[model samples]
Target: MSLSHALLGLLIVEPRSGYELTKAFEADIGRYAWQAGHTSIYPELGKLAEAGLIEVTHEGARGSRTYAATDAGRDELRTWLLRRPQQSKVRNEDVLRMFLISALEPADAITMLRGIAQHTAAGAAELRQIRELNGPATQRGPAGFGLLAAEFGLRQFDAIHGWAQWAIEQLEATADGSQDGAAARSVG
Candidate 1:
């Protein structure tokens, strides 16, 4: 989800102010996936402007500038979409931290499991809300693809919740067994 490429795609659709592009990103793509902050987006736009991939026009409306993709930008975008993109490396800090927690006491691990369960539940709730907001009506006709993606997100969230519950139960059982074994050893 490179901000530069996304900005190019948006410009391809039509000329837009930076504010409008940000709004569209947050509402559509950023809602489900790919987060782009103003820092990244603005800088990318500047670079694109410098490269002549996009041009800016000032209409003297509160001194705001609008941007549109140039022919070079369109060609670049086409090349980008058609070419094979490098696979991005996934770095899940939470998952990595959880793996490291094996060094902690069993109780601490169980506590982490509880936190994960809570997070997953919250994510599921958010996904449900997104699905409700973007119902079948939103998907009808031209928006059908977006609607399908929203449904996929909902399903993914549900799966996450289910897996989280199962994981928590398993971790709790393991922690209990470990504690029981420790007690038996002390008694022996």
Candidate 2:
């Protein structure tokens, strides 16, 4: 997720200090997507301000700088939202590790499968929470892209969980030599 675009979208709605933006981002979008930290946010804000995409006003006493999107910024943000985003490469470490598990003993592979199952179960729970929070907002016909995303997350987690279980069975079978109808293989 692009923190700059997310921040700009919020600022376009209303002027807010950095603290308020962080809190709102965490409360709303951050549940589904990763959020930016102070180190990244402040630098992005400075760059945006320099480029005249956002205007900053300093408030007294609190010493907080409130930012609002400029006309140009709004235009830019609109254009960005309308444009198709580039597809990112998918890099799943779990799948890669599983592909290389033949290097390890079957017992070790089973252990890894168990761990993956636990992780996938936890991920499914998180996605369920996201779905509940989003509620009807995700089911509003064509505008329910967020709902589609949440559903996708749910399915992906489910698949991962199923794959993990299958892997465990396969590893156990290999370890016991059940598939070949022979004596159990001892791990040396």
Candidate 3:
């Protein structure tokens, strides 16, 4: 999804200062969906205002401007959300790394896989804590919807952790087979 789309969606839920939105993205939305830096966000906000998609609703200290989506922005956001996306996707870094992992030495790959398993397990555990802290979602608003996304992320972590461990097992079995062959050759 486009950065503009994310900004509009966040604003639709509630008006927020640029600083607030930045923090929101840092902790929540950016983690689950799109990501943007403050530099990009400020400029995007300006562009949205110029396009009449958003407007400054409040002025805070240090020239911070709070933005809210206009009706046009809401319509645009809805249209974009409803539109079916093409099959193409932005490649994930982890997936790219996994694809390239075959280039690594077998031992190194095993080490990397172990790291992946550990990292994902930690992430999943953290998300579980968040889920417990959140209790349950009662509505489909930001808090509730965000919790849904967090759950999806938690599942993804679990799946990746399982896959990494399986890959390590496959590599270890290959090593074991190679060692047995080496010993057989020495005996012969």
Candidate 4:
């Protein structure tokens, strides 16, 4: 989804300063989905305001301005949410690197795959910690949605870790030059 839509969605809950929105994205929203940096977020807020989607509702110290979604903004956000989802383009550096492992030695590929598994496991653990910290919030309605996303993140990491381990085992078998190695090579 576009940053504008995401920002507008966040503002629907309550008016918040740009700093507050940045923290929300990093602390909650970024955990499971998109992450928009402060630089990007502030600019998007400006654009949303220019489009009459959001407006300054409160001003605080250091030029901080709180923004709330305007009626036009709410309408735009609702329309976008209701529309058919277009094909999403994913850009994962880790996956891209994994795909290029054919250029590396088998041992090196195995090492990389093992690292991927380790990293994924660590990430899953981190998500678990976040979930535990938000226990009460997860039991409620709006907050429960965040918990659901966290659960999905956990599942995704589990799958990635499992696949990495399986790949490592397959490579090890190939290196042994066993009959199964021939089958594995043929399948691959």
TM-score of each: 0.67, 0.67, 0.83, 0.79
Task: List clashing residue pairs in candidate 1.
Answer: none
> Candidate 2: where are CA atoms >4 Å away?
9-15, 24-32, 57-61, 70-92, 139-149, 178-188
Better of 2 and 4 by TM-score: 4
The CA lDDT at 115 in model 2 is 87
Query: CA lDDT of each candidate?
Result: 0.74, 0.76, 0.87, 0.86
Residue-level lDDT for 18 in candidate 3: 89
lDDT for each residue of candidate 3 in 87-171, tens digit (9 for 90 to 100): 6867779889999999999999999999999999999999899899886756566666577777888999999998898788778
lDDT of 2: 0.76
C-alpha RMSD of candidate 4 = 3.7
What C-alpha lDDT, on a 0 to 100 scale, does residue 62 get in candidate 2?
Answer: 71
Count backbone clashes in candidate 4. 0
Q: Kindly list the per-residue Cα lDDT of model 2 for residues 36-140, writing each as its tens digit.
A: 667777788888899899999766457789999999899889999899877788677867897798898878878887888898899889878877866754354
Q: What does the lDDT come to for candidate 3? A: 0.87
- Residue 48 in candidate 4 has what lDDT? 95
lDDT of 4 by residue, 1-188 (tens): 88999899889877889998999889768756778889999999999999999999999888999999999999999999899987778887977887898899999999999898999999899888878977844475445547767888888999999889888877888788674865666579
